[model samples]
Target: MTAMHHLTTPDGIRLAYADTGGTGRPLLALHGAFGRGRPFLSLADRLGPDWRIVAPDQRGHGRSDRAADYGREAFLADTATLVERLDLAPCVLVGHSLGGLNAFQLAARRPDLVRAFVVVDMAAELPPHDSDWLDGLPETYGSLDALRTEIEARVSLGEPLHFLEGAVETDQGWRLRWHPDDMREVKRQVFGEHWADWYASDQPALVLRGGASPIVPDDIARRMLDRPNTRLATIDDGTHDFYLTHRTRFHDAVAEFLTTL
Candidate 1:
């Protein structure tokens, strides 16, 4: 079962998170853009009783307070505070997309806090692409079904409907829990070159790639694998959100890796 909790950052923004309560080793799981902590629920379950999974809704996403600052420094500070405040130092860090970038940087800046790392479908050098869809997102939907339809239309081909996990029903109608403007700003900061951070830490790392993903190209994955003690695995039919789409394969890969550590 999952329990909800809140933590106030030094900046005073209240961040919401979900924890799979147990006495097992801590695993800090972070979601990507347009995603919240709840989607990790299945992965946490699959990890069994050995892992006490903690998934947080990063600032300006999910139930967390939307802050004015969407800079890279601000996001990193929030992760550091969460790790420090919760006494989760030396915990395993699992992140997807935007969260993956944050995880590697955190591991670089505060190596003492991260024991191991799992980065899904992200690379140091992200290819530039138009994000006009983010700016064109509708502010509100007439109903949940309407929102689902829109989300289904936008998601990549073959991705499950669960990718819309970030959507929530509000009194005003249905809408995304995160603000589009905030997401756009965060995206702006997320882009650009970041190879230094990716290669900074030699900590045991796993770079999971979706065979069909365009974000983390084959060459980048190969370079990441060149790091000592790091390994690369690809889910043949998986997309960017393969953890959700191919849970069993993803979990097995993670489980096998953890056993080696």
Candidate 2:
């Protein structure tokens, strides 16, 4: 079982997280964009009682308060505060997509706080896509199904419904937990030269790639191995959201990696 908690950052944002208490090793699980802490409950259960998974609704997402700054450093600072405040330093970090990038960046700068990290389906450098998709999105949808249908039509491909996992249904209507403007800006910040950060840390690491994912290219995934003490694994039929779609397989891989530590 997981317990929910809240903390006020120096910037006064209310960050929310779920802590699955256990007698085993702690794993800080960071979800990708449009994800929240609640879903880690499924992962914690799947990993069994051998692990404590702490997942947070990052700044401007889920139950957390919105932030004016959506840059990489801002995200890093939020993760740092959660780690230090929860006394989770020297623990493992398992992040997906945007969360994965945040994990490695933190490990690079604060090795003292991170024992090891797992990057799931995220490349050091993000691939670019058109932002026109968000140009005319409505502020709210009449219902969850309505939002899903609308977003699905616009997205055309990939996991469009995944975005609804972080959506909020208020009295007004169903809307994303975060603004499209924030997501767009953050996505923009993600596309850049990050090879330096990728190679900055020598900490033990595991890079899990989705076999069917178009996010992390083969060349970059192979280059990721050049960093010392890193291993790469792939889930053959997996896609970017394989962790959710293939929980058992993802859990097995994560469990196997923990044994090495």
Candidate 3:
């Protein structure tokens, strides 16, 4: 079972997170864009009675408050506050896509806080995709069933969670979590060339790529492996949202990676 908690950042934004009970080293799990802490539920449970897993809903996603601005520095600062507030000793930070970017930036800024890191299905350089594609999602899914069908079809194609689409049930009916303008802004910040320079340190990091994912291509994966103590693992038939669609497999891979620590 997992328990929910709130951590108030220095700026007073309430961040929601889930903490699962366990004994050994603590691991912080960060979800990708369009994802919340809940999706990692199964994976945390599967890690068994050894590691304590903390998954947080980043600002502007899930139960967290949406601030006027959302950027990598803001997210990283919020995470740092969380780590200090919780008094969690050095931890293994697992980040997916957007989450992954935050983790790297945090480590680059404060290397002593993290013992190791795991990046899932993302690379320093993001693939070329039109911002118009994201702008079109609000009009794409008319109903929940349509959204579900779209998910299934794209899951069939091995697209991951961040790339699939976003829709949530609200009083206003099906709505998206982000504004198109924020989406474009955040996307550019994350995909820029500076992201690679941030990972220049010699830290132990694991980069997991979904076998059929386009987000993190083969060449990029190999480049990440070139980093200090970085290892690459590919889950066959997995997509961007590997944890949600292939929970057991994704969790198993994470567990295996932890075992090496």
Give me the candidate number with maximum lDDT. 2
The candidate, 1 or 3, that scores higher on TM-score is: 1
Q: Residue 86 in model 1: shift from native, Å?
A: 1.1
**Model 3 residue pairs with clashes:** 160-240, 160-241, 161-241
- Per-residue lDDT tens digits for candidate 2, residues 142-176, read 99989999888887434764577777888999988
Better of 1 and 2 by lDDT: 2
TM-score of each: 0.95, 0.95, 0.85
lDDT of 1 by residue, 1-261 (tens): 577899998888999998887788888988887788787767666778888889999998888999999898898899988889888889988888889999999999999999998998888888566556665778789987888887777755335354467677778877787887887788888889898888899889989889998877888888788777898989988888888888899888888788878
Instruction: After superposing candidate 2 on the true structure, give the runs of residues whose Cα lies further than 4 Å from its correct spot.
Output: none
- Candidate 3: residue 229 Cα off by (Å): 1.0
Each model's backbone clash number: 0, 0, 3
Better of 2 and 3 by TM-score: 2
